[model samples]
Target: MTTPPYDGQPQFPPGQPGQYPAGQPGQFQPQGYNPYGQAGQGQGGYGYGYAPPGQLAGWPIRVGASILDSLIISIPPIVGVIVALVIDGDQDELGPGGGIAMVTGFAVGFAVWVWNRLIQQGRTGQSFGKKLTGLRVVHAQSGQLIGLGSNLGREICAQIFNQLCILNVIWPLWDDKQQTWHDKVVNDIVIRL
Candidate 1:
């Protein structure tokens, strides 16, 4: 155990200068201060891709939104049909044309489709009913939310796909990653966007 020139002061070993002296880990020598070290590196905080979210909330959120959207959009047509019914009795009018059943059906269908399309078009990518229902359409490679043209493609497929015998709706279910058949055709995914 070497001692300092003063006799008992703790000193660094002959070869190790900046290292802790002796067995005392707390004893350190001088080095330049690192006040800015690791700056912007996020060492003291969450970095990129630190942790992924545990649960997916797409379906639940979209389902709730659909109910809300349906209720809200259905109001106009419902009111229109009621007014039409009172005015025309069995006639057609400005509020809605034809008998109550036909008028109501037309109004409801039109309002629903319009509202669905508008809302879907508002987001990062367009998703009609199924898209709004917790499923996102994105490019396969970039994993990015689809843009205008692709989104339009997806929306069109989704809308008319109702007639494709089950292939229309069931495609997403069969996808390895849960993408719809329409998604496959469009090179997209029904993922959490």
Candidate 2:
């Protein structure tokens, strides 16, 4: 029997999806076949996992956001520390309240951090500081807000990297995608709204 001429359709065995035919090395690929699993530039700007879309927020703006957030979270704790000191007032030791005010202040500050960084930022893509700066943090691939769990991990990584070296914060200055180490770990990008 004579074989049929190639009609541009992949010849797959029955019960198989339109996958690339196997054992036919260098054969013509099916339409829309992407070995990398992402569409080409014509489809959707190269899809995800390669390049994150949207205009990246500037480093200065990002730093501003960080500073703003830091100040907001620190206010309570600083006030508590100041109050505790004033109460002690040259005493050899802490006053009757001891470190209660300081502890309470830190707790409040931690709560604020959780709410702003993990909860709000995860759900809305913007923490208070980012919102004020007209910026957002989103998944690098999906271009959507990273969830709370991811935000938590990202925050932990950020802390660790920041403690390890100040480069983590400043790395974005010269990065092609402006991603810090924590951002890379979480597969995230910062963009201006």
Candidate 3:
């Protein structure tokens, strides 16, 4: 029988239709050059493992959305405190440390929960809140999936305005790339759905 040409389409040689080249090695073709010319890999140009779709948002825009989300979630706990007051619980007798403790507990617990969710989602391909809101996180350095530490750092910084609750939210409003302190630390970003 005769072997078919490699250019047009795949055809079996002689009697076969799906046979490969007899001596061709396993798949190892070099990658084609990217069309977009940007910074070098170390400077932020696309390289290994970079997604085809690019990022979801710059740090500032993400911060805005996060601040918006935090306002929504934080309402419940505030309501709980308000309800306690409406019931006429002794405010002074609640103990001097009660407010501090509550703040600490909520901050710590919430941070930990957000961190775990972000890391898990990032590692598994979806941050908890991001999953609900239709967003995601990706690595900046390696361009592979990011982990908990970077994600936690990113989340904390992402909501700096929410955390500060007075004026930090406006910081991103002026930022050119909209990066908050956390994103600068972890070199990551949040993308939307």
Candidate 4:
């Protein structure tokens, strides 16, 4: 019997329609075939996956936000001190009323700071400072809001570093990821909105 003539198209083995033949060097794989099984899935941008690099909040903007937040958080306590001084004018010691005023002021300020920075930020990813600065804190990998645990951890780490005189707020200035020590500890990143 005469052998059939060779066709122009290359033949694939049975049951392998789009796969390249085994042992074929330099052969292009079929379109849309991803060996890692991630075909057609794009990397997430913001709020789902990590924001693209180079879009993180810069040090200057973050510093400005910190300053603003500091001023805002200090207002109540300053007012309280003033009121205490007025109430206790010319007194060598602070009376009970003056003490109460000072304590109340400090407590109110502390409560406001905690609410804004911890609770609100945990739920919404933005503190007052972050909101004003158009920045947000998110999971570094997932780009989701950092929850209360992460937020608290971040704050604790920051406080520890601050106590150590390490200047945690300025850490992002020299960090490759633009993350402070607390951010790194919590696997969080601050990104522009």
Candidate 5:
């Protein structure tokens, strides 16, 4: 017996008109096709039944992660300011040593922020808080980790949106993908691991 010739189209029946085949062989499938059963990526095909990596992280957990990260980054600066205040007690102007302490504190805090949020998260897709909370940030369409440059830009946008209004961070509460304004800025999504 001879098998029937197969076109590039899928072995299964075709989907609705104008839609790409379920599992066309390519490194990156079209936006509307999903052979991996991931959310919003596209419909899965019979070709390979791969499980989704994760579900969208909820707003509450994301908020918790944010708070945790804020605390982590705030500690150094707050401690420094406290030390400066102690050193300059009852003095209107800060002493040289007090000023140095305050500056050092702020610098350390900034370094921590950069390491935790920009470098680590950019490389692993999970900041310290996100790792603790079992969440990861990834490209919205590709489900891959974003690079450092994108992470830096995303952080800048996050700061702007956060300063603009509370709604920017709170957007994830009602967003379809549970994405904050910053996540949207970088085309990223937070997923619960």
Candidate 6:
């Protein structure tokens, strides 16, 4: 049979697999066209990148996680209180042993809370509460797991502010970045997983 002329152009140039023509859909655009340059770099004109602005965890979810964490961390103290009540029995005041038990309970609870919230969360980017809530705490700039320092600052400083000032926790509700005061201090963000 006589051969026919192939008049149509090939979909891709020879040897350029997976590459599309300029201005074509699915083609990679140059840097200038990118709305956000790099993952950790600052946004268009805003501050540091620290997780994408839109991907931040909402106030309600964050609050829920906080509540769950509070409950989990309070167990030790609650047990201590029960023990104190048992020891005190009919006495109007807590006995020495009961007082000690209560203090010990609070100390142990604080330690456990710090371990999970500061150390484990810093290393893994999630705590029991965060894991359950499908949220994570990550470095603001890199969006990577936070380090011990950041975790400590976040848990101690930021958390204290949230606890003391109701507005600190509520700030995220109206804040543009959706960050709690603590998040800003540690340069971390609670993001939905």
Each model's lDDT comes to 0.46, 0.73, 0.46, 0.69, 0.74, 0.68
Which ten residues in a row are the worst by lDDT in model 1? 46-55
List ranges where model 1 is wrong by over 4 Å.
1-75, 90-115, 118-123, 126-135
Residue by residue across 52-146, what tens digits does model 6's lDDT show?
Answer: 31256889998898889889899999999899988888788889989998998999899989888988898888888888998888765555678
- Per-residue lDDT tens digits for candidate 2, residues 9-122, read 323442243222332332222334333344555334231222223357889999999899999999999999888888777677786674888888899999999999989998
How high is each candidate's TM-score? 0.47, 0.73, 0.47, 0.72, 0.75, 0.72
Model 5 spans with C-alpha error above 4 angstroms: 1-52
User: Poorest 10 consecutive residues of model 6 by lDDT?
Assistant: 1-10
User: lDDT tens string, model 5, 2-112?
Assistant: 223222223233343332244543222324344544444444433322112466788899989988999999999999999999999879999998999999999999999
TM match of model 5 to true structure: 0.75
Error of 3 at 47 (Å): 8.9
The residue-level lDDT of candidate 5 at 46 comes to 31
* Highest-TM-score candidate: 5
Give the alpha carbon lDDT tens digit for every residue of 39-115 in model 1: 24332321221110111224345445446555656666677666667666754344334356556756776767555
After superposition, which runs of candidate 2 have C-alpha atoms over 4 Å from their true positions?
Answer: 1-54
Each candidate's root-mean-square deviation in Å?
18.4, 12.1, 12.4, 14.5, 8.8, 11.8
TM-score of 1: 0.47
Looking at model 4, report the run of 10 residues with the lowest lDDT sum. 44-53
**Ordered list by lDDT, greatest first:** 5, 2, 4, 6, 1, 3
Better of 5 and 6 by TM-score: 5
- Candidate 3, position 107, lDDT: 68
**Tens-digit lDDT track for model 4 on 1-193?**
2212122223244236433343233222222322224535432211122222225778999888777778888999999999999999879899998999999999999998898888988889888888998888877765567899889888878779878876687788887667888888898888776
Clashes of 2: 0
Candidate that scores best on lDDT: 5
User: What's model 2's TM-score?
Assistant: 0.73
Measured with C-alpha atoms, the lDDT of residue 45 in candidate 1 is 22
The clash count for each model shown is: 3, 0, 6, 0, 0, 1
